[model samples]
Target: MGPLIWIIDEEWLDYEDEIRVLEQAFPSCAIKKSGYDYRGDLDKFGYLADAIISQIYVKLDAGAISKLEKCKVISVYGGGYDRVDVLSANKRGIAIAFVPGYCTDDIADYVMSCILRANKPIDSYGSALNDRIWGLPAAGKLRHRIQGSRLFIIGLGRIGRTAAAKAKALKMEVSAYDPYVNEEAMDSMGVRKYDSLEEGLGEADYVSVHARLTSETEGMIGIEQLSRMKPDALLINTARGKIVREKDLVEAVTNHIISGAIVDVVAVEPPSFDEPIFHCPGIAVTPHVSYLSVESFKELKTRTAENVVKVLRGEELKDIASV
Candidate 1:
């Protein structure tokens, strides 16, 4: 039989608890780790049997997949396995397991916070005091009483639903756009439903994106669609970057096409100032940590380890979406 596993992911550096859990569970099994230089150790220890587990969002390419001749499974640490070419894995009979709830609440909270910040008066809300301009922007204040305003959600999955619920709690009228959603089911959540993107933009005071990154979703929000939004509307993206074109966002924000904006991710991570996004004012940029929180990170680590062990043992897995 192949060795027990190969772990390839950023989570390896971040989740010691998860590493410990896997170590304890697979004490006698042979495992190779991406960050651990297990390949060099293989020269001394000899190649053991091979199995592989990966944190979600790891590099997924033909070259990477070609190296996994002995891999039988891939356990993604967090949700959104777009980083993995699912069709390729499926064709190779390599089943992939994912942890879905890792960042559920964290992302929901972050999305709501961004929306609130955008709507809140700049002078009073306190985040505009970045000291960049020595607080000149602080002189220009934002105004809001969000209680009666409308919030439109682009996706209606778990995180999307959570955001909608939070918006409702904040007394904001919630509308969602997802043709795939069950009408009766969505209605029970007190969220209004819009079948098209244009409808959502036309009626919303704030728009929060929670969609997945798929072929159908790439660059779904760009100049053409952004033009449909209310002149003073807020656009917030906690979802994957490709959903919105990075260039279009910069142009929109730079030109003040939208009232204000917040993005937890960009189509390109750490986008350059020359790319135009970095030069825009009234836009908040956060390094892809909307899904990160101490509480959620703990849960993510535990779930990741559990999934790894399950895959190694050929056990049934959870959250195996579309594969």
Candidate 2:
């Protein structure tokens, strides 16, 4: 019998066109599917899987990892794999793969869109016009011009570097804080490097986060960090939600500690009905989809299946998770 590959999660199933590609690529293998209802109980179906493709929401915790007796590869459907228990997967000699560079342009464009909104009266003015309010009273507030404004980015990974380049094109002064990235690299990109995050936030008219979610970064931007940002600074986070504590963010925006936030993620996905940030006036929240574009979507799906085939055939895989 051929290898059994389980493409778990209904989310991936929705991409019917993409699955057809996977079917063709693994013609000899039995490809199966499951609904969102199969989460936590992954072990029951996982034991027989030679390899598995998972959705971003599916948490392959340590217990779940222990049950994958025959699984050789785990292909995450997106850029971030924080939900996957990498340590356990590594201990068991399982290869975890992720599609990373595919989302660089998409995420950078999303962050740039938020930056443009920060300096424009587009939303407020359009809403007033829609309500038939004649006189442009909403235009009274002085908007920050994109040119000559300071933009600070936390974490200079692919997304961060891309955002910095875009900001520079708009004639904005760009600076960044990333311990992992060297000052020479930042200098070459024309981005000023800040020794500390506080120093970076203090001088910014806008701040964006692109850090990975790890022990060092979870709740990285709490009250003390938020307090350091300029009162009118606009904050953008397309990165992980846990990087910023939700309650602290609510308090900051509620009391106007920071002017507003453009958040594409939250501590929880589809946050509880009572998620206070939704009620906060100056915040814009998007369902964690910043890393999406038609092109990137196709790349992510194709690479996921390709990685599994490579592992099954004993070939070196691309973008092996830093687990």
Candidate 3:
């Protein structure tokens, strides 16, 4: 019998790209597709599967991992794999692979867009014009200049570094706070490294978050951190949702603890209609689409399948999880 590959998410519009890649690399492999709310027998599915492709919403916890009999790897569709239990996968000798750098440029561009939107007040002007009101709105008169403004980045990973470069191109003074990244590295990029988060928050005209979601980062930004930022400072988060406490962010923006916030993610995906964050006009929330672009979407799918092939063929995997 051919190897079985299970794709455990109905999120994709179609799986032609993944199917084509797998067929080219492993002709005889069988593939299965399931919805996000898969209620089928996981035990049978896991036992028969040679490889699995999963999205962020599917949780492959320890109990789930124990059901795998022949699974070689779990290929995550995106950069984040927090939903998968890495320790359990490691214990069972199953590799975890994710597609990284597929959306670096896309995410960096989105961050720049948010930063510009916050500082320019162009949208406010357009809204007033749409309302048939001639001349600038009161908000438009308070537009802040982007050039020479201070930008503080929470984490200096791939997306973070790219954002720093783009911000510098706009002549914004960029600084970053990442304990793992050395000052020499930031110095090379002409970005000042901050020893403490509070110090950066207090001085920044804008703060952008690009930190990976980990135990150390969950709920890292709270009221205390928000209060530290300048009253007019803007915060941008295209990273994980839980990294910033949603309740605290709503409070901060509602109370004008900071001028505003631009978030592509929140503590929950598809939050309730009455979610407090939605009620606050100062906070702009996107549907967690910072990593999406026509190019990045195709790359994410193709590379995700390629990672599975690499594992099944005993080849070294790219972007392997560091569990």
Model number with the top TM-score: 3
lDDT of 2 by residue, 210-311 (tens): 999999999999989999998999899999899999889888998999999999999886468578877888899987788888888888888877888788
Over 4 Å off, model 3 = 130-132, 136-141
Cα-lDDT of candidate 1: 0.74
Give candidate 1 regions above 4 Å deviation: 1-4, 10-14, 35-49, 55-57, 121-142, 270-274
Better of 2 and 3 by TM-score: 3
- Using all chains and alpha carbons, the TM-scores for the candidates as numbered come to 0.86, 0.94, 0.95
List the lowest-lDDT window of 10 residues for candidate 3.
Answer: 135-144
CA-RMSD of model 3: 1.6
Candidates in order have lDDT scores of 0.74, 0.85, 0.89
Report the number of the highest-lDDT candidate. 3
| Tens digit per residue, CA lDDT, model 3, 1-323 | 66799998857889999999999988888998877665465754756788999987788888888888888999999999998999999888899999889999999999899888777656567666667787533455464689989999999999999999999999999999999999999999999999999999999999999999999999999999999999999999999889999999989988989989999988876467578887788898888889999999999999999999999999987689966
lDDT for 23 (candidate 2): 64
lDDT of 2 at 176: 96
Task: For model 3, state the Cα shift of residue 189 in Å.
Answer: 0.2
